[model samples]
Target: MTSPVPPADPHRLPVTFRPTRTRAVLIGIGVALVVVLTVMSLLLESFTTGDRVTFITTGLLGLGVLALLSRPKVVATEDGVTVTNLTTVRRLAWAQIVRVNLRSGDSWVHLDLSDGTSLPAMGIQTGIDRQRAIADARALRALVDAHGTVHSAD
Candidate 1:
């Protein structure tokens, strides 16, 4: 019998790494909202009937999921950083980024470009997303430091 070859080494560099936030917390929150709605229905039954509870619960869950998942996109490439919005994408050459404060506020990576505009990193606003995103941020910072010579940060 022929032996199978193992998969190529997973640590290969020059690959595009995407930062992602987990949906567990959001899902949990959705569940909690449903429970809260159910409880509220029992207490505030003057307006909502028994049938409305089901509809309200389902609607709330859907809205929660949608809101939680609707986030911005941040990408790093050999050239520079890219921030994406709901309908548009912004690309900043490493040179344009003056300072990147990977700390505080609205749960996002804060960016300060040379022109005096500040924006947050796209993903990992909460939960596991924070941990993973911080790690990736470190890596991206390192990569930028080593390669982005023309681009400086303070």
Candidate 2:
């Protein structure tokens, strides 16, 4: 058995969203395939029908692999925040983000926008420092306070 390891100090903020239902389903199917593989091994099979199972397991595993590879990366600079998704990147001015807080479960950064809208910043992950995360959020709040106006993103 191995022990758990804590996350190292992250120099760059990379936000991740809650795994989508589609992704979770893929993982669940992969796990189920493991069970099926066990059953097939015990049965008297000739050519092995396990090929179908193997292909399914591989496909599901591929989904998980794609999810990880396709996750977005978020970077904060003095001027603005950048959200880099798989196909495109969008930059939001600091003024557009009224506040940024690690969500209750520390899953993602929740952005309270100037338009009374909230957005999940899927590019950053929640880390151990809850207090630090809150403090970081406050700093973002200050930035918006200085420059943000209603309908800024509009």
Candidate 3:
């Protein structure tokens, strides 16, 4: 049997769930890459102006991609939940979310919607930190239970 879910923290409303370590690491790498490229472009005597610009531009592009990778987040509020993935953002009401799941071997939390669709909540990924992901998923599930309408079995 699974452990009981802890109560949702009411004071933590407007809470944001994200991969903390992954985001920090990605952002740190991005910043370091940009700085290194910029310094190289300025210090290299053999590089032409065009070459320097190209190097800086390439670094910036790489940073942009890393930024995108670190952008996933799930925000929960009294109104509803807002899921922001790599390239998409979706908002759903409490009633619209039927369940929140983070099963074993799953990479991230998946929200089962009343519309019969499942949305990948990349913000709570298990790969980087499994315990934290499970806690976050349980918290989200508690929130859904507290706020969402209860459906009767047919």
TM-score of each: 0.53, 0.43, 0.89
Q: In candidate 1, which residue pairs clash?
A: 109-121
Candidate 2: TM-score?
A: 0.43
RMSD of each: 8.4, 8.1, 4.1
Q: Per-residue CA lDDT of candidate 3, range 39-97, in tens?
A: 99999999999999999998999999999999999999999999999999999998998
Q: Which stretches of candidate 2 lie over 4 Å from their true place?
A: 1-57, 60-70, 84-90, 127-154
Clashes of 1: 1
Point out where model 3 deviates above 4 Å.
1-12, 150-154
TM-score, structure 1 vs. true = 0.53
| lDDT-best of 1 and 3 | 3
Clashes of 3: 0
Q: Superposing every Cα of model 3 onto the true structure, what RMSD results?
A: 4.1
Q: Which residue pairs clash in candidate 2?
A: 14-123, 14-124, 15-123, 15-124, 15-125
Candidate achieving the largest TM-score: 3
lDDT top scorer: 3
Candidate 1 error regions (>4 Å):
1-19, 23-68, 85-88, 104-106, 124-126, 150-154
